[model samples]
Target: MAAVAGIWLYNKGAQHLVSLAAGALLAMALLRLLPEAQEGLVEQGLSHNSLFVFLLIGLVGFFLLEKLSLFRHNHHHEHDGHDHHHGFDKEEAGRGGWMILVGSGVHNFADGLLIAAAFLTDVRLGWLTAVSIGLHEIMHKLSDFSVLLNAGFTRVRALAYTLACGLMAVLGGVLGFYVLSGFESFVPYVLVVSASSFLYIAVADLIPQINAHKGLRAGLTQAAMLLCGVALVWLLSPAHQHSHSHEMEQHEREEPHALMWSRSVL
Candidate 1:
C-alpha cells in the first residue's frame, strides 16, 4: 500500500524526491531520534557521551560498508572491462539504497518495540502509539522509495524490498511483546545507531546527488521540498505522541482505575 504509493510518486519525480528524502532523514536523525536517545540515556543514568560515541561508530561503520560495496562493484566492472560514467556512480547509489533499508529496518523495529511496550502498559496507549507510528511510517516509506529508485532499483524490486524492510516491525513487535521489559534499556542505543545511518546516507549520498543539479529555480524547489520533508517529521514526531500519552495519564488520574480500564478494554 504505502510502498506502492511511494513507487508511484517516485515515478512522478526523482530528484525532488531525493531532496525530500534527504531532508526527512536529516530531521528524523537530528530532531527526533537523537533527542529521544539522549533523554533515554539520562533516564538510564548513562553518559550522554556514550550515545555520541555509538553514533560515531555507526557512521564510520556505514562508511566502511559503503567502501566495501564500492570495491566489489569496481572489481566486477573491471572484470567485465567496461567503463561507465554518471553524475552518481552505480555503486554509491546501491550503497545508499542498502543503507536506507538498513536504517529504516532498525527504526521500524524500534517503533514496533515501543508500540508493543505501550500496549503492554495500556491498550489505549498502545493504540495511540500504533497510530502515531503508522503515520510516521507512511512518510518514511515514501522517502525510502525515492532513494531506492535513485539507486537504480526497478519499481517492482523497490516495492518488494521496502515491504520486506517494513515487515521487520512485525518481528520486532513479537519480540517486544515477550521481552520488552528486558530489552527496554537497549532501545535508545538502537535509535542512536539508526540515526547515524540516516545521517550518513543524507550527508554522503543524497546531498551530493542533489548538488549535481544547478539552477536558481532548481535550488529553490529542492530547498522547498527539503523543508517540506522536515516539516512532515516535525508535525508527526513522537513528542506529540508523548504529550498525548501524558494527557491520557492525567485524565485517567482524574477518573477511577475501573473506569479507565473499562474504557481501555472497550
Candidate 2:
C-alpha cells in the first residue's frame, strides 16, 4: 500500500502530504499510545522495578539477537546495484534481511498490543509510552530505509516500505484492543517481551553498525546519542519510573553555559 501510494504519487505535492502524515502518525504513537501501556501495567499491579526489569530484558534480547546475527552467512552481490560497506556478501545480508524483518515485525506487532493495553488502563500512560515507542520507531524506519535503498529499491519504494512497516502499528494496536479483552491478564509479560525485542535491535544491531562507522571522534558522538536516547525515554517515563531523574537532573545542572556558538565577529 505504501509503495503504491508513494510510487504513483511521486511528485513534490504528494511528498509533502506523505511527510506530513508521517510526522502526525509518529506524534500520535508517541504522545498518545505509550503512556497508556504503562498505565495498563500499573493497573495490573506490577511493580515499577518489574517494569524496568522487563525493559532491561527487552534491550538485552535485541542486543543478543544482533550478536547472533553477526555469524550470518552471505555471498557477493550488489544491493540494488549499489556498493555498500559489505561488497562481498550480498546474499548473506539478504537472508539476514528477511530474518531482521521477521524479528522486527514480531516486535512491532507486540508494540501495538502493548500500546493499546496501556491506553485501556489510562490515557496518560498511553501518551508517554507512545512517545517512547515513536523514538524507537523513527530509528527503526531510518535503519530499514537504508537497507531497502541498498537492496536496489528506489527512494520512493523504500519510503513506501518503511511506511507500510509503520502502519503495522495500527493493525497491531487494533488486534491488541480486541483480542486482549479481559485478557489484560498478560500485559507484564507482553511489555517485557516488547521492550526486550526493541532493545535487542537497537543495542545489538543498530548501535554496533553505528559504532563501526565511527573514528575516535565518533565515539563521543555515539556515546552522547546513546545517553540522549535513554534520557529521552526516561524523561517520558511515568512518574513512578522516575528512578533516574536525579542523575539526569544533576547532569542537566552541571552543563556548561554558553553552549551555542554563533558566528565570530573577530
Candidate 3:
C-alpha cells in the first residue's frame, strides 16, 4: 500500500523520485546492511577477509546474472507512446521477465535472515533492524513497481506480483528463525550475502541510472537525496550494538531463564 501510494505521488516526477529511491537504497546498503554484516561476522569469529571475499562474490554474481539476462532491473525512457533506449535496455524486454520477481524474492529473503539473526542475537538490536528493514523496503518495493511498469506490466499486475514477492520476506523470516535457531554459524554468512545484495543493487543498478541527469539542479537534487537516504538509515540504526549487547547480558544475568525463553521464541 505504501508503495502504491508512493508511486502515485511520485509518478509525475519519476526521474527525481527514482533517483531519491536509488539513493535511499544505496544508503541502506552502506549505512545499515554492511555494518550489521560486519558485526555479525566478527561475532561469529569469522575473518574479515572471508567477509570481503563473499561480498565481492555476491556483487560479481549479480553483475554477471544481469549481463547474461538471467536477471535485470528494467530502466526505460519513453518519447511519446514509444519507448526510448535507456542505459540498461535498448529494445524489447526479454522473456526472462520472471527474473525481476526472482531477484526481489532473493533480496527479501536475505533481509529476513538478517532481521532474524539480529533478533536472535539481541532484542533491541532486532527491533532496530526490523524497523530499518521496513523503511528501506518501502522504497525498494516502489522501485520494483517502476521496473515492472517499464517492462510493460500493468500497474495492477505489477502490484500483485510485487506483493507476492514481498511475502518472501515472511517465508525467509520463518526459515531464518528455525534454521538459525539450530545453526547460529550460518548467521554471519547470510548477513554477508544480504549486505552484498544491497551493495550490488545500489552501485550497479541505481547510481549509473541517476547519473544520467546531467543538469546542475538535477545533480544537486540527487546529491541531497542521496545524503538524506544515508542519514535516515544511520539515524535509525542503534547507536551501539555493543552497548545493547551488554544490557542484554545484564538482563540475562538478572533473569536467565526468562531471557533464554525469549531468545528461544525468536
lDDT of each: 0.69, 0.53, 0.67
Model 3 residue runs over 4 Å out of place are: 14-23, 68-70, 75-103, 121-155, 240-266
lDDT of 3 by residue, 56-94 (tens): 988888788667644454333321133536564633443
- List the candidates' TM-scores in order: 0.58, 0.53, 0.68
Q: lDDT score, residue 169, model 3?
A: 80
Residue 178 in model 1: shift from native, Å?
4.5
- Model 1: per-residue Cα lDDT over 1-266, one tens digit each: 54555555544765777777778778777877777778888899988788888899989987886675531111211222223445758888788678777877876676677667655544643554454355345545766766677778887897889999888888888888888667777767666765776688678767876788899999999999889878877776667667888999998797897787899999
Selected candidate, larger lDDT, 1 vs 2: 1
lDDT by residue for model 2 (176-242), tens = 8887767767754665564454444444444545545547766555555555555554455555354
Ranking by lDDT: 1, 3, 2
For candidate 2, the per-residue lDDT at 106 reads 62
Alpha carbon deviation, residue 266, candidate 1 (Å): 46
